[model samples]
Target: MTQLPGSYESYWMESVAGADHRALAAGLEVDVAVVGGGIAGICTAWELTRAGHSVAVLEADRIAAGVTGYTTAKLSSQHGLIYAQLLKSLGAEGARLYARSQQQAVEYVAEVSVQLGIDCELERVPAYAYAESSDQVEQIQAEAEAAREAGLPASFVTETGLPYPIAGAVRIEDQAQFHPRKYLLALASDMVGRGGHIYERTRVVSLDEGKPCRLTTEGGATVTARDVVVATHYPVFDRAMLFSRLEPSRELVIAASIPGEHDPQGMYITQEQNTRSVRTAPYGTGQRLLIVTGEKFKPGIGDVSRRYEELAAWTRDRFPGASITHRWAAQDNTTTDRLPYVGRFHPGAKHVYVATGFGAWGMSNGVMSGRLITAHITGQELPWSKLYDPTRLHPLREAPSLLKLQASVAKHFVGDRLPASHADSIEDIAPGTGAVVRVEGRRCAVYRDEDGDVQAVSARCTHLGCIVHFNDAERAWECPCHGSRFATDGTVVQGPANRPLEPRRLPTGTEDSDR
Candidate 1:
């Protein structure tokens, strides 16, 4: 097998020595049960705990080890020319509310880190959305004007600190970059100190909504709470049909150690080259970690391994003398209208609230979600609550994007069933790789290891019955339809899909003879 450079683990996860919390082993009751232990859940739980509400956070895996740990960790409100679009779609007042909520999150993180004495390496830096192409210059200018109108400290500029040149840029100051895991882990610990409970490796499989919502874990442990916040990144319980409203995309990230003099000194992004985001974190003495993220594509679609290469090449070419030290991927969901759904889970639900679809700017948005959801549960009316309400109907604005997303999903669901999408026979399968092939006229996801051992699982995704595609980069079966992922042996990796893929046994005659 060809060796891949650097570790597959996230740099944030590797840098911090995290403390483990036990999984759910018995049933319990709390005032609030927060599902998902990443940024949103932990922040929500922490806020609730501080508010004198009994809260318990149930995590499918380790706290902050999921998407939170994999993020670029830029805590800024400059989410790539969004103010201009928000001004058009949501109007001036709505855009102002959006800016205020996000800017508050940035300030909130700084305040909390200082109050709690958590050295999260929070640094105040300017953020920029630059135009690499001349055609994008006008867009940048419009964004600058729109952002300033929305009350953000934004301005249009032609010069930046990037090694390469730019046409125009929208610069926003008083933003920040930090170590998310360190910050979140500290918050998790503080939540514990405040009598809040955290259970790791406890996956909630079902939710029974009522006056006091009930959640059942995969291990059969039960949690009943007066209110529930489904902060799961993809939302495990999608009673509101978020699968259609939200679109999932995975992006590649590469980090390299650069000399202190080479640090970018600020956060930057460009829509050119698919999507490029650049930021830096303090590393070992006199060194900085240059984190570059780009090559956004639908999960489970296309050549992810090649996308990694393309991102790496872009980094090497842009930052000379920088050696790639770590590589990882982060997945995010974008809503039809581009703003996150952060209030009530659905129109009918009374006790269930949801926070998802932050696009690619989860750091600030996640903090915003924590505060917004807390206010909702506590009956504190917030100015921006209605703006982020999941039930808000924007038919004219959302219809086009929603329809386009559903069409792509329908194509994947029905189109992948065709014969051409499958391999001819197991004999053609290569070692250390996986493919969907037909066995006895049934589609099976088969993988042959380098040792010539074979394993097969049903190709159907348990979430939506979409065919699973093998991701060579991650060595997992990914559902292109809804972003559910499973290991080659069929264990669920990420969700929206709660169950593992069923195992399949190949007929003896169909086995490759070389094995």
Candidate 2:
């Protein structure tokens, strides 16, 4: 087996320049305060600043270091066989509106990159959704038809640039791809140039909804703003039980260097059950990097190592000579109705807006979110605003999925409280792995770090008390209920859970076991 790179580092992170933003230190007032410094927050800040609004962005970490940095960075409206489902759940007009918004977002990114002279490796290419077997061909055909009806330039085709053969495919022309971090870095610079304040390592802990909204930081500093955008991949403030409504899934991504002669001409994704997304990025003057990503599962529910091995096997079988370069994983939220929530945080909360549940197509949706939220804040009307309104509901279409997700939450919430499946002593956990063990009758999360030290934390998720499972691949504690994740040392990594996992004291006898 090929040894994987150390701890989940994304290809974009290795290439992009870091932003030297300081943490929020004192109370301040701004026209708009945007939380989360990924693409959604940065784009929102850029748009608001462009409109002459004084915008302040408060990020728990550096800019573009979240989902944006980890994405496949395909800037396309061709979101894997979605139009057909949209045509069914939403009507034709709704589907068209979604298509229009996504296409406009793609164009907007291109326009911005060109206008800003950002060399983010932006390239225009066709996107394809293909089927490996005849059984899946009809879905591809239907998707092509639905896409065309929804204003996307799509057509049914059997021939593609992929190395593997396909039964059929839906090809969408003029789709684009780029290095998301580079693009966002340029935008962040422009936002600062326009008098926008962006603070890194500054986490917004609580929000007070009023005429002038107040956000309290983890450092005890306050930010008062007329409007606030909670663009933090998963909304941290769960005032309306947003966690229960959105289902979270984790997907693994791996990039490898391939022979220049075998570079694919377009981005492609499989339409079958085991979805595989494929795209190529320019590595050097004459070489290309092939990025293959898939293997999605409910967060904290699967064997992460096995999933990574499976993806690696799939890649080797297809491109035997490919050299593994980078590997990472990203978590995305999916709503019951298959559309994102990108408007007001909730009904009756006019000043607070949120954008989430983009599924796996956040490249375009993130940009659309920034544009949509900015429009609402600046008193400008957008046609597709109602479709993405967080308050909108389709009870009949959404009820089944919503109930299913809630049932899973209840099962894990109760199941995790019972007992540890394996009664192996905490010392049995090998180095570089983690497990839940009963410490003096209380379940605790125990991770044996690489340096042979044992790190323990309360297994209970700080969000809603759901028991968190150890993700061995990432060395993090992940909540099965609503996707809250924490590092082994008990710091919050992903949220909806703003508080870090509570540190636990190891039993006296367990301290020197590894020694």
Candidate 3:
């Protein structure tokens, strides 16, 4: 897809002031080495520390700068339509256990917030999934029944106060919302205070998942930990075919300082083609609601203009007078059956834990993942362990996901080599637009404004060398392969593309095909 990156609305963490950094150096050891600094890693570290075990968190960048940086940050157990589907796919016991686990996670956040005196805008409200179609209504009705049977407090509704048309909705009460960053920061402080070491900017280069796993960072640092938790959004252990087990989803988020009066009572989502979910928390003295909108499937193939327009329209329709301020987008890891994977890395591999595929509900699932993983490592009998195990059969069939990922790979890999006959310079592009400038047979994405200033990025996609598509609505270049995103100036906004876009070696006048 041509859509690049999403906007960066302030959700959760408020103060993440740290240096641009790297991985560990030399050799080190800890009781547990948590790889990833998002809510899951941070929360796990906190718990491990509280349990009196020495812990170390290794982050590839500043704290809270990954998918955790890009979440809607809704701290609730109302995963949309999950209970009914899980019951059908994994049985009723599995569904009820999953619901209880998520609810306990939500309560855990509130308890942690109160216990730690964190100021992350934690609020209790209802979560809803509005269905605008009769078929979806039937689905939600079954879902509501399943939810109630699973011991969750949920109901079906035909009368939502939304401005849009709807057939019915599934409402789960006492669901919650919060600022993700605040809670994470509070946990990070606790972790550090309890003698847990957090190594910022420490990108893990290699993982040894044998007994007493040895994790090596790029900087030659070897950390020997009894257990390693890979909460790195997508797992670093790709040899297990973990990437195929889950699908990645990208969403655009816009934060508007809307009038508090316009915010409907609770957090809401709909089953429209482009669904809309809303929640509001006090940003300052006045209220600013974070309208998290825009979800395009990963390897976003075609274009995103329609998607952005849909989000903008939703914001305008939902709260007309809202002042649009911080606009951002977040990409999430999703699984085929909608349930996340959280447990050991694989069946045979012990002591190498992973938590991934949280769908769009990272906040709660993340907390649950941390708790479950911590329990697993400690060999404790914890409730809900079976529901989140990594070795569980694909809750749904996997043929479709495997086919989809293979198709994406084929499509992008074959077309990634930049075209030979592309334009030579920024002068070739018109004002208020961009073009894929070709130089010495290498393609670079170039954009020129009304002033004729030029910005260029290598056309080669960072993931698998596929060319990237430039998205104008968000002004970031998106890789059609695996959804890597780059800023117009070649900065890495997202990955599977782990590196920034390469810059041109010469001026725009160089022949694109000369190389």
Per lDDT, the best of the predicted structures is: 1
Preferred candidate (lDDT higher): 2 or 3: 2
Q: TM-score, each model?
A: 0.98, 0.98, 0.87
Give me candidate 3's TM-score against the actual structure: 0.87
User: What total of clashing residue pairs does each candidate reach?
Assistant: 0, 0, 20
- Return the candidate ranking by lDDT, descending: 1, 2, 3
True-structure RMSD, every candidate? 1.2, 1.3, 4.0
Tens-digit lDDT track of model 3 for 1-515: 23323334444433345333334676888889998888788888888889888999998776777888767777788877678778887788988888899999999999889988897778898888877888777888998899988888999988765656678888888789887877787788777888988888777768887678898875678999988888888775565676655666677776677656556778877657666777776755557665656555554343455676567666767677766666666787776567788888887877788888888889899999888887887779687887777777763365677677768667666755635423456556665456676655667787665565667778887555777766655667777666677777787665555567887765644333222
Which digits, one per residue and each the tens of the lDDT, describe model 2 over residues 179-248? 9999999999999999999999998899999889999999999999999999999999989567878999
lDDT by residue (249-347, candidate 1, tens digit) is 999999998999998889999988899999999989989999999999998785788888888889989999887889999999999999999999888
Task: Give the lDDT of residue 16 in candidate 2.
Answer: 73
C-alpha lDDT (0 to 100) for residue 368 of candidate 2: 97
Error of 1 at 295 (Å): 0.5
